[model samples]
Target: MKAATFFDGIGWREGVVELVDGGARLRDEVPATGIPRLDGVVVGGFTDHHVHLQLVDHSQLACSRLGRVVDLGGDPDVVQRLAVHPVRIEFAGAFLAAPGGYPSDRAWAPDGSVREIADADAAAAAVTEMAEAGASCIKVTSNSVAGPVFTDELLRTVVELAADRGLLVVAHAEGAGESERVIRLGAARLAHAPFTERLDDDQIARQSASASWISTLAIHDDPARAVAIDNVRRFHTAGGTVLYGTDLGNGPMPVDLSPREIAALREAGLDDAALLRALSPVDPLDPDSNLLLLPGSSPAAADPLAARPLTPADLKV
Candidate 1:
């Protein structure tokens, strides 16, 4: 319950956190539980901002250290079932795209997982359907690399519809000009840091000012990796919100916190605090009921990947 370093919302400090009624309370003194000493720092549970619940095993994810997840794309029915799982889930029902667009033909994307908007007039209805299905946000695909993308008019309609519904919009922006197009259309977030093209300073500044970009750095292994890293580095330096995400289930990756992804963010100039902020749960969701306990004196700052998420059951009174 005591930690030499504790993340007290603002920063890490020497303090003790007491477990109470499935929540954590910071206190100066607390009775020991007769348990062995835990020489690590404690912090709030981590959230992966982008994942696909339908593509990955929900049970495996719940057992991992991640205490929360934001599923960017999935089938409505399947994703809805996961909402009641142990780990907190904030999901976007499905990938809204043009007919025959990205993920529609992919083997991993199931039927009913990709809703195609053929007309701009249907944009509002599409968003409403997802909202009815319990989607916290709306996800769109603007990936020209795969197939036809939404026309500007349709994209604008989707964004406007989501805004009217009080929902944030996230887009999978790929191919040249896609990132800028998504930002210009007023989407609230990007599924991945723009990797298909290197964003110039102006573009970086504009994207940073307009939308948060999820860091899926570990998904790329070729030359695109450098471009993504540089873009994210500049985006973070420009004060943009960089969320931690691992496009999980897109490839072979760890179900839990990914050390490669964490290291990649670190390489992109996100110091400990910035990295933790990316991992921290977003608002509208209650603070994580669990706590993260590491095994060391907590470095100058916390290494997110090193911390172990602990539930109330894992803690001894």
Candidate 2:
């Protein structure tokens, strides 16, 4: 099918892609100006690896140019039901955290969405429950800013349980030193970029050694965005794996490809290739066909516009 590519780094590019069994398969990489003015079906499908689909207006989300979402923190039953739709739903069942941790007080968090665990045994049970309920992975929150965060011992136990269950552990680590703790525990992914504190050399080294950070820079206001950029810069310098994500439902934000988040990544020093890699659905370590396409030559080097902070308008059906 014909398609218009949203080259995340440069401008958008036009091309044709074939969707086989619901996944994109590159058909032909056509030149931008050479895009044939022919008539055919065009599919603009892209995956948002981290999202809280049930919390947001799914109807509004449909307005964005996104094909699917990987719900990082939500109800597994809702996720199971969501999966029956054409827009694929992959997820971590719920937000597993220390008792009285984040999202518990967040007004948007649903009744079953927060799975609070106090100890290692409880953590294991929580992880097992999520798995049995059809979680693609496990999400654990360690946000001291909100309330009591996970203890090192508790975090270790949760990680171990996740490992034993053959599930990837994603942590919502915030507050001083939480990044280091998760890094040391070998978290598979971070729910948000480390915004609470900058990483020390050892911490950065550990972060580089393992773990990937999802970008949710657009959620923060001016000062916070600046802090987030600095944090991301250091992580990038240390060679940490960075993935593009927008905490879609935490507040008002874009439902599709987020340009402001992309701009923040650029400000943090990601170059063309790195930006592409960050936006790419394909894993960088093991290349795959899930590459995003934007139909144009790299745009002229232009002064970066201020962070617009994405809103619903950016998303299109």
In Å, residue 53's CA in model 2 sits off its true spot by 1.1
Q: Write the per-residue lDDT of candidate 1 for residues 181-241, one digit (tens) a residue.
A: 9889889899999999999999999988889999999999869999999999999999999
The TM-score leader among the candidates is 1
**How does each model score on TM-score?**
0.89, 0.77
Point out where model 1 deviates above 4 Å. Answer: 1-5, 8-10, 13-16, 19-38, 83-85, 281-288, 311-317
lDDT (CA) for every model shown?
0.80, 0.67
Q: Write the per-residue lDDT of candidate 2 for residues 1-317, one digit (tens) a residue.
A: 43333333324445444445655444435635644432222222455678888877776544455555779888788866763233456789889977888888887898789888877778878888898987878998888878988878888888888888888888888888787777787688888888776666777777866888888888888676777788788888888878778887777776767777878888898865576556543221111323333323333322222112122222222
- Provide backbone clash counts, one per model: 0, 15
